[model samples]
Target: MIQNEIIETIETIETICSRRSVRKYTADSVSDEAVLTMLECARFAPSGLNNQPWRFIVVDDREIGRRLSELTHYSDIVASAPLLIAVFLDTDASYNRDKDLMAIGASIQNILLSAHSLGLGAVWLGEILKNKESVSKILNAPGSFELTAVVAVGHLDESDPGTAERKALDEIVFKNKY
Candidate 1:
């Protein structure tokens, strides 16, 4: 049991460390199963008071993708990726606004990590939030749903986007108090 636990821990850390924001992808499409799998991982993300406010709209239609792409500066990736998952916060289901938003962020992170593990490249397009209303309208999402993020996923065309540089723990983390 201890040996299995160690392996699982290593695998989890490996996945987290190696995941990257893939902006470029191939023309090939992402399978429905793969998309569902990512969402499955997302749904498991922790939420405050067990109120899961995260909702997803899978945008596989090229026309719709193009429309959404125009709403953000990351238009090239959004318009070109074979799949886009629009993450939303169901306001009606939320308890505390701040906590629910954090939960939604966790959910989006899960989607990104899951995509990496599945050998699919995914990019979380938060820049689109500037036109959140436009995105919501284009997707036909209900008024109660607030657009949180739009993640573009597809078969990777370019080489692995290795991890970016990060600040040392001492620079960002404190022992007891800052």
Candidate 2:
């Protein structure tokens, strides 16, 4: 007899539905285990030629977080969160530069969904991209690594911003050709 029985699981669609961008956060801290778990999800994301050129800087230090907050438009949110994760792309390791970037985007999506499923509030701030050179220096990123985004993570506050409206499928999808 086969010993391994399949376990029932929550629908991924439901998790997708529940995912939202949370800007405000509570004082509660996100555990290191939680951060690792989210990154593990990101680790599984597909990459071109399996380069997997994603690098991350997890900043739990309040001073560093404050500095990062100051550098981004979402200053209040970044400063308030218990943690900040700086996502990076390795330009030199990429098999195909442009395709590699799309892989990094997949990794980011994994982090966001993983955060939501774990009951943590998180937000992705692209403001850092505008000052990538300076921000990369601040983070001490390797020459091959390019800073892409910064994600703030913490406990969800009472005032949830709720889900923003999204365009209907019909509005975005096109058959065969555009």
Candidate 3:
């Protein structure tokens, strides 16, 4: 029999393992409490020199979320999600953009993992930054930060079968020097 702690950890793994993109959500509104909690989880992600260049902007306003959804081609599945967070890399934040982007990716992962643990679903959408002008005006992003990714979140409307397929272990793994 598994110890209680191990069982709990197993459950978390199961939740993460079966997680899937959920673009459809009920009419439920995401509370500020949930949003804060998710950001709190993101706060601890590793950053170069602990600079923590990632900034999370919450879009709860249906109009604003809709605007961003349309601007980024976030899709109905993503648009229907209750909340969206714009993850930014504060390039002028005493770090280079490349390092900031890596940190921002970690921060985004934190948000997604937290959502999965909470029975919510999140999808990481990239490159909306290519339309920087629109997204900047939409979110009113600060000059110091460059929008890198967006995360849409909500309670999943249906079941999650499993993770996407992975390359065979042998295909990716390498020994000593590869």
Candidate 4:
């Protein structure tokens, strides 16, 4: 049993390392089942007081997806991806702004990792905050739900070799003194 747990731990770490912001995607469509599975994984993300304030607007319709794409700077990428998930926060349900925002971030990370684990690609768009009001209206989200991010999801185009450069542990980490 311990050996299985170790293997699972390794797999989780590998998924985190392998994930990349895939900006390009194939023409193939992402199934509804897959999207539901990703959301299920996200539901388990930790939250302050177990508030779990995150809400999602899954846009699979072509016209709605196109309109949502227009709301973000990553228009081309969002327009082409087969799926778009509008992540929102229920302000009323949150304990506080900061903690809820942190929880939302964790939930989105879980969604991205879950997508990668299921052989789907996803990119988080925070720029939507610039036009949050417009986006909120477009998605018809309730007044209490504040738009936080727009995630474009689909099968990644393998032809594009996206880079995932990062600082080494020695460069970013510090001792207790530091």
lDDT by residue for model 2 over 1-178, one digit each (tens)?
A: 2333222134576777778889888888899899999999998999988889889988888888887777777789888989889999888887787888899989998999899989898888897788888778877889988998888888899697756799877788877353
Q: lDDT scores for all predictions?
A: 0.92, 0.85, 0.77, 0.89
What are the per-residue Cα lDDT tens digits for candidate 4 across 122-153?
Answer: 99989878999998898899999999898889
Give the poorly placed runs of model 4, Cα more than 4 Å off.
Answer: 176-178
Give a tens-digit lDDT track for model 1, residues 1-178: 9999999999999999888888888899899899889999999999999899999999999999999989988899999999999999999998899999999999999999999999989888889999999999999999999999999999887775745688877888879363
Tally clashing residue pairs in candidate 4. 0
- Candidate number achieving the greatest lDDT relative to the actual structure: 1
Comparing 1 and 2 on TM-score, the stronger one: 1
Assess candidate 1 and give its lDDT. Answer: 0.92
Looking at candidate 3, what is the lDDT of residue 154? 78
Estimate, for each residue in 132-176, the C-alpha lDDT of model 3 and write its tens digit. Answer: 678878888888777888898877766544247777767888773
CA-only RMSD, every prediction:
1.9, 3.2, 3.1, 1.7
What TM-score does each of the candidates earn?
A: 0.95, 0.90, 0.85, 0.95
Off by over 4 Å in 2: 1-10, 176-178
